[model samples]
Target chain A: MFFFALIVKPLVLFILGLNKRGQNNLPVKGPAIIAANHNSHLDTLVLMSLFPIAKIHKIRPVAAADYFLRSGFMKWFSTYCIDIIPLDRKNRVNKKALFAECHKALDNGDILILFPEGSRGTPEQMSQLKKGVFHLVKDRDDTQVTPVVLRGLGRALPKGTALFVPFNCDVVIGQPVPAQEKADDFIKLLASRYDNLFQYCVTHQEPEQ
Target chain B: MFNIPQNSLYTMLLVLLFLCIGTITRLVLKAKFPQKDYTELRQRIQSWWWMVAILFFALVFSKTTAIILFALISYLALKEFLSIVPSRPADRRVIFWAYIIIPFQYYWAATSWYGMFIIFIPVYVFLFLPMRMVLVGETKGFIRSAGVLHWAIMLTVFCLSHIAYLLVLEDKNPQAGPIGLVLFLVIMTQLNDVSQYIWGKLFGKHKIIPKVSPNKTWEGFLGGLVTITILSGLVAPILTPLGFAYGLLAGLIISSSGFIGDVVISSVKRDLQIKDSGSLIPGHGGILDRMDSMMFTAPLFFHFLYYVKY
Candidate 1:
C-alpha cells in the first residue's frame, strides 16, 4: 500500500499531471464514506492516489460487479489490490448483497468509496445521485459521508479514448454530511452538495491564495 | 563522444550528498513531528532523484542526445503553458504551428546555426504567430491572444533552447564544454532556488513582493543571491574559461536574473490563481515551474559565455 500509493501512484499522476485539490477534507483515518462524482476511468486512480497509505488502504470503492468483476484479471485486481465491493448494476441489482457488502465493510471499520451517479455520466453539473448510496448510510448513523466532486477526468482521459491529455484533476471535497433521516432527503443533500462543489470547481478557476 | 567533466562529476556527487542529507532530514523531521504530513517533503526528495538521474543521462549521452532531450523538454513545457492559458477554438491551427516550431528551434541548435536559432522564436515566430492568428479571422481578444502565444513560445522555446544551444558553444571555445556549461547553469540556478527557500524559512521576515508571491522575502532573495553567487563563483572556473571574479559575476547575474524569472512566472500563475504551473514534477508545480528560472538563467548564461569565453 505504501509503495503503490506513495511511490508508484504519484509517479503516474505526476506524468499525467493530475492535480488533486481539497484532499485534506478527506478523513485521515477512514471508517467514513467517500461519495464522489464519476465520469472517467481516471476517477478510481485519482481517488486512490489522492490519499496517503493509512486512509488509502481503508478505502474500498464500490465498483460495478459487471464491469469490474467480470474479467479474471479484473476480478483478481478488484478482490486483492483495489479491494472493491462488487455491485451488480444489472436488472435486479442484488440490493441485499450490496447492502450487506457496504455494511460488512463499514462494520469492519473501513472507508467505502461510492459514485452516487451509479454509472459514469458527463456530470455537466451532476448526474442524479442514485438511491443505493443513500440507503447504504441512511439506516446507519456511524458512517460519515464526504461529498466529493472530481473535475477534469473527462479531459484527462475521456470516455471513448485511451490516450490521456495532461490536465489538472480538481477534487472539491465538501464538509462531511452526517447521515440524514429520510433517504430521499439524504440523497437530495448529497446531490445539492455535489452540485455546489461542481459550481465551486467551475467558478474557482484560479487556485487558492 | 564525451567524457564527464571533473566539475560535472563533482557536482553530481555533491547533489547525491545533498539529496541523502535532505532525505535523512525529512525522515528525522517526520519522526519528530509524526502528526504533521511530510508528503511534500517526500515528493521533494523523490524529484531530486529524478532530476539527478536525468542530468546524469543527459550529459552521459552524446551532445546530439542532450539537444534532443532539451527539445523534448521544450515541447512539454510549451504544451503545458499553452494548455493552461485560455484561447479560442480558432487558435488551434496557430497553436499546432507553435508546436511545429519546437523541432525547428532545436534543429537550428543541432545544426549550430546561431543566427537563426537566436532570432527564430523572438523575431520570426513572434510576427508569424500573430499573423497566423489573424489569418484565422478571429479578431476577438486578438492582441491578448497573440501576445500570450508569442510570449509562451519565447519563454518555453526560445529561452529554453539556449540550454541545448550550449552544445554549439564549444564550436567557439573548446575550453567551455557543453556538458560542463549545462551542468553549471542548471545546478547553480536550482541551488539558487533551494537556497532562497531555505533562507526564507530560516531568516525571512519581510515579504519582498507579498502581492505577487507571498512566500518570497527580502532575506531569502539576498541570502540566496549571495549563496548562489559564491557557489557559482567557485564552480564556474571548473566548467568554463572564466576567472574567479567573472565566475562570481556570473553567479550574481544568474541568481538575480533567475529571481526575476521566478517572480514573473509566479505572477502569471497567481493571475491564473494556480498554486503551481502544473503537477508534472512533484514538489515542483509543472515543467514551467521547474524551467521558469531557466528562462532567465539560460539565455543570460548563454550570452555571457558567448561574449566572454566563446
Candidate 2:
C-alpha cells in the first residue's frame, strides 16, 4: 500500500536525483497547511512524494476542481491515493461547499495542501493568492502554515502537456508561519515566504552546471 | 597467535563504546540545547548503531562473505554519489568505465592481488578515464564534464576500493587476518568522527575556519585525536601488523586526515551551497556525508597497511 508507492516512486525517479529540501518543517502532528506555489500538475506528486506520507497524516491537496475533478478516475485517485481536494477556479464566489469541505478536513486535524495562487501561472513569479487559505486559518489559530515552493515540477511536466520531462524537482518547505493578524498582509507574507523558500532551494541546489 | 575471537569481541566492545558515546552526546545536547530539534542528531546515532551492528556481523561472518558484503556497500555508496553529481551524455562511456573498473579494484583485493589493487584506480583508471572521455569527444562542457566525472571516480571508486583492499593484509595467524584490519580501520575512522563531533559540541569555542564547517571546532580535533590515539594503541596488536606505537600514530593520522576529508567535502557542498549532500540516508544527509571521513581516511589507512603489512 503506502510502502508500495514509497518504494516505486523513488525507484522510478532514482535517475533524476529528485533533489528535495526543507522536509524538516513538516509538523509531526495535525492541522498543518502545505501552502505551495503551483507550476504544473506534477507539482502534486512532487510535494506528496517528497513529504513523509507514512509518518504524517494523509495530505489533502487543494487541486483544481474544474480541471482534475472532471474525470471520474482522476477525481477518485486524486482524492484517495494522491489525496487532493479539487476546487473550482471559475466559480470562486459560488464555491462555498468546497470551502466547507476543506475547513472540515482541517478541523479534524488532517493535513491540507493548498496552492495559494488558485491557478497555475507562468514559472517565474507567483500570482495573487486567493482568500481560501486566509479564510480557513483566520479562525483556527493553532494550525501551522508551511510555505512550500515546488520549483522544477512545472518544467518537468508543464501545463496542458502530457510529456514528463526528466529534469530534477526541488521541494523547499519554509519554516512554519503561525496564524496572526492582518489577513491580507499574512497572505502576502506567505506568498513572499514561498518566494524566499524557492530562492533558497534553487540557490542551495546542487547545480548540474 | 593473535586470538581472532578476542579481537572480534574487542571490536564489538569498541563499537558499543562509540554507540554509547554518540547516543549520550545526542541526549546531552537535547537536554542542554533545548532550542534545536536534536532529532537529526538522534537519528544519526541510531543509524551509526545499525551500521556498527552490521559491521560487527560482517566481521564475525566468513572472510568471503565479509568481502562480498563490503563490495555491495561500495557499489551502493558509489551509486549514491553518481546519482547526485550530473554527468554529461558524452561522459556516459566513462561512467561505464567507472562502474566496471571500480568493482575490480576491490575484486583484486578479494582475489589477493594486493599490488594491483593498490594502484589500479590511481595509475591505470586515472590514465584511461581521461582518454576514454577524450575519445567520446563532447568538448562542449570540457571542464565541468571532466571535472565531475574525475571527482566521481576519485571519491567513489578510488577512495572506496581501499575498504576492500583491506582484505589483502596478512597476519602471523590466519585468525588475526585482514577482517580485523578492515574492521579496525572503519571503526577507528568513525570513532574519530564521533569523538570530534562530541568534543566540538562540548568544548568547541574556536570556529576552526567557520565558513567551511561552522560546527567543527579545534577543541573537538584535539579531543578526538587524543582519544583515538589511545584507542589505536590499545587495539593495534589485535587488528594490524603494526606495533602499538605505530598503530597509535596511524590512529592520529587517520583522525586528522578524516577531519580534513570532512572539511574538503564540506567545502564542496559549500561551493554548491547545499547543507547535506543528499538525503539517501535518513539521519546522515547523503552519500557524501557518510563518505566524507572515508575519502581521506581510506587512502591514508590503506597506504599505512600497505607499507607495513605488504
True lDDT of residue A111, candidate 1: 82
Computed on C-alphas against the true complex, the DockQ of each candidate is 0.13, 0.10
What is the C-alpha RMSD, rounded to one decimal, of candidate 1?
6.4
Give candidate 1's TM-score.
0.71
- Candidate that scores best on DockQ: 1
Off by over 4 Å in 1: A1-15, A21-148, A153-166, A171-184, A195-209, B25-39, B87-97, B131-139, B171-176, B198-207
The C-alpha local distance difference test score for the whole of candidate 2 amounts to 0.72
- The prediction achieving the highest lDDT against the true structure is 1
Model 2 CAPRI rating: incorrect
Per-residue CA lDDT of model 1 for B109-222, tens digit only, reads 999998999888888888888888878897877887788888888899999999998876654324446677888889889889989999999999999899998899999999
- TM-score, B chain, candidate 1? 0.94
